[model samples]
Target: MNTKRLGTFVAAILVLDAMAHLYWLVRPASDPRALSMAVLNMDVPFTPRVLLPLILLLTTAAIAIVAVSRGRGGWPAKAVVFALGAGLLVRGALGLVWSSGLGTDTGTPFYRLNLLLYTPVCLIAAGSVGLVLARTRRTGARV
Candidate 1:
């Protein structure tokens, strides 16, 4: 598969997500339903609310650089992709515990929205990146 395309896809999603987070961070009231995409129904410190998405944005940027660069190889690429996948997995899917019929909802739309929508996207992006990285390693292509 084309790792560059996958990287682009991941970058696009992460950029959008980062923008959304940044918006919410700067204007915390703009988020409809008043629930966080990263944190569930609980109150979060300003640090995570601002930094998580910013850090994720940087991670995606790095992934895009590695994927698009011709020098893509070695542990650097692997480490970046690994970190991206792990971060997305944690931020996206894990929130299902509070939203997915676990019966602990704070009754915010974000829970359902996250569980049904963005989290899946995150998982897909992460999986695609991992698949591309693995393919690159297997075929010895400069993914």
Candidate 2:
């Protein structure tokens, strides 16, 4: 995909991920069912106390990178795509371990959801970058 589309896609994933986490952060403690469920399902550390601002900062950075890279074509886009994908892949593996028994708890639903979501997103993003890089390399070889 082109840089613009790639950046937009990356940004979308970042925004969605951030929003999902933020939703969990803002949920009230009074709702016993939800609070209990949250305690059981989510493993995130911040709660509203720390999570909201951090997510916003991360999403903003992703969006800003997209906005700035609109005109550029080449390594920047590829790098970001690869970085995002690699980050996810590594984290997902770690999550599997954490959820399986390595950690104190299996983690929250919110954490699990992000972990699951990142699997495919990272695959697509990283695969796209790898494919592009391979094609470019082959074409360069021909020339």
Score each candidate by Cα lDDT. 0.63, 0.55
Over 4 Å off, model 1:
25-33, 37-39, 45-49, 52-74, 91-99
Candidate 1: 10-residue stretch with minimal lDDT = 30-39
- Tens digit of lDDT per residue, candidate 1, span 24-75? 6666554434454334555555456556767576656555535643346456
Q: What is the TM-score of each candidate against the true structure?
A: 0.70, 0.52
lDDT of 1 at 20: 64
Evaluated with TM-score, which candidate comes out highest?
1
Worst 10 residues of 2 by lDDT: 134-143
Give the distance in Å from residue 13's predicted Cα in candidate 1 to where it truly belongs: 0.8
| lDDT, residue 77, candidate 1 | 63
